[model samples]
Target: MIKFENVYKEYGNGVRALLNINLEIPEGDFVFLVGSSGAGKSSMIKLLIREEEVTRGRILIDDIDITKISKYSVPKLRRNISVVFQDFRLLPKKTVFENISYALEIVGASRKEINRKVDRALELVNLQDKKKAHLDELSGGESQRVAIARAIVNKPPILACDEPTGNLDENTAREIMHSLLKINDAGTTVIMATHAVNIVNELKKHVVTLKDGAIVSNIEKGGYYCELD
Candidate 1:
C-alpha cells in the first residue's frame, strides 16, 4: 500500500507544488490522477520516485517512510517503483527488443533472464512481432508501448505514468490506455496522470482529481471533473 500523510512540497523557487496531500492507494489498483496543468501531478510523481523530497510529512510505501531514507538507498527503492513519461524516451537506433532488454542488462541480468523477461514484456504489450523493429519503424502508440514495456520489464509493484497518452491521437491514445490496462490487470498498481477526458470517462477507473496542488476528490470508477482549460 502507498500512503501520503499530510504531505507538502515546495520548490526552491518558493512555489508550493503540493499542499497537505493525504492519499492511500492499495496494491493492484488503477488510479487516474486528473487535473489541469500545474495541478501538482508531476510533483507527486517526482516524490514517488524520490526525484524530489517532500517539504513536510511522510510518504509511506508499504510502511517504509521514503522521505527519511538515505540518498544511497534511493536506487534500491526505485526497483519497486517504475515510471513512464510522455516523451517515450528510447534509443532511436536500438531495436524494440534491445531497448527493453537494455534495462535488465544494466543490472547484470544474464542473457537467458533478459530474453525471458523481454519476451514476457513484449507479450504484455502485444508487441511480440515488433521485437526486432527499430524506433523509426514504429507508430506513436507502438513507441509508447515500448516505453511501457521497458518500464515493466522489472515487474515493479507500482507503475506511475506521466501523461502517457499525451502525444497520441484519440484512437492511438485508447490503444495506449488498453496496453496500460493490461499491465494493471496483471496486478501492478497503475497511477496514470492524464488529461484525456474521453478515455477517463470511458474507463471509469478510480479518479483522483487535483486542483491547484490539492486533491479535490478521489472517486471510485469516476470520470474527469476538472475543466479542460
Candidate 2:
C-alpha cells in the first residue's frame, strides 16, 4: 500500500509543489494522477520515487515510512518502485536485450538471472522478437515498450510512469497503454501521471486530480475532469 499523510513539498525558491496532500493506493491498484503541468503531478511522482524530499508530513509504502529514510537507503527503497519517464531513456549503444540486462547488472544480478528476467520482461511487452534491435532502430511506440521492459525487468511491486505516451500517436499510445495494463494485471501497482484524457476515460480506473498543489478530485471509474464537470 502507498500512503501520503499531510504531505508538503516546498522548493528553495519558495514555490509550493504540494500541500497537505494525503492519498492511499492499495496493492495491485492502477491509479492515474491527472492535472495540468505544474499541478504537482510530477512532484508526487518524485516524492514516491525518493527523488525529492517532502518539506513536512510522511509517505509510507507498504507500511514503511519513506520520508525518514536516508539518501543511501534511498536505493534500497527503489527496489519496490521502478520509474519510467517520457523520454524512453534506453541506452543508445545497447540492443533491447542488453538494455534490459544492464538494469539488472547494476544491482549485481548474475548472468543466469539477468537472462531469465530479461526474457520474461521482453515477452511481457511483446517485444521478444526485437530483442536484438538497437534503440534507434525501433519506432516511438516500440522504443517506449523497450523502456517499459527495462523498468519491469526487476519485477518491482510498483511501476511509476510519467507521461509515458506523450510522444506517441493515438494508435501507438493505445499499444503502450495495453502494455502497462498487462503489467498491472499481473499484480504490480501502477501510478501513472498522464495527460492522455482519452485513455484515462477509456480505462475508467481510479483517478486523483491535482490542481494548484492540492487534490481537486479523486474518482473511481471516472471520466476526464473537463468532460465530467
Candidate 3:
C-alpha cells in the first residue's frame, strides 16, 4: 500500500538523511524498519507523516502521490494512517477516554459515534477499566496502550510506530508487541521502527535494515543481524 520511488531527503546545511530509498509495503503486511541512530529511519517516518518533504523523487500511498499533496489536503491524507510514538504522547490532563475521544472529535465525528469508537478501541487494548484514569495514573505499558487506542480509534488502514518499546522492560515490551501483532492480524498494515533486537528476532517478520542513509538489507522472516554488543 506504500511505495517509495527513489526517495531522498536532505536537511538544511547539506546533510542528507535518506538517499534514493526505494521500498514497497503491500497492504495488510507487517514490516519492521531497523537502523542505528541517524541512519534515516526517523526521516522515513517523518516523510510518511508529511512532517518533512522529500528532497527528490516520489512517495505513493495506495497509488496516491503523497509528495505532491497540497498542504491544505495533508490532513485528509493523514486520516488514512495512524502513528504511535515511543513516548506516549497523551495529553496529561485528559483521561484515557477523553484522550481517545479527542481523535474522533477533530475529524467531526458525532458524539454517539465517538463514544462507541472510543469504547471499542479501549476494549481492543484491554484498557476499558482504565478509561476513567488520567495519564499520570497509568503505568508505562498502560499509557502506551492508551496511545495505541487513540491511534486506532479511527481504524486507519496503516499504522506506523517509532521505537514503541524503547522505554519498557522485556516482558512489557513483549506485551506491547503482542498487541501490535493482534492489530496486524486484523488487517491493519503495520510498520514498526524499533531497536529491540530480541523482539525483532523472536517475531521473525520482514525486516529492512539501513545504514548511513541507505538500505543494507531487506529480509523476509529476518533476525537481528547487527552485532551491537
- Best lDDT among the predictions, by candidate number: 1
Order by lDDT, highest first: 1, 2, 3
Ranking by TM-score: 1, 2, 3
lDDT of 1 by residue, 1-229 (tens): 9999999999889889999999999999999998999998989999999999999999999999999999999999888999999999999999999999999999999999999999999999899999999999999999999999999999999999999999899999988888899999999999999999999989899999988889998898899994644
Per-residue lDDT tens digits for candidate 3, residues 1-229, read: 8999999999889998999999999999989999788888889988998988999999999899999999998898778888999998999999989999999998799999999999888877888899889888999999998999899999999999999899999998988888888888888999998899999999899998888888888898898768532
How many pairs collide in each candidate, listed in order?
Answer: 0, 0, 0
Question: lDDT tens digits, residues 173-222, model 2?
Answer: 99999999999999999999999999998999999999889998998778
Largest TM-score belongs to which candidate? Answer: 1
Q: Which stretches of candidate 3 lie over 4 Å from their true place?
A: none
Where in model 1 is the C-alpha error above 4 Å? 227-229
Worst 10 residues of 2 by lDDT: 220-229
What value does the lDDT take at residue 7 in candidate 2?
98
C-alpha lDDT of residue 61 in model 1 = 94
lDDT of 1: 0.94
What RMSD value applies to candidate 3?
1.2
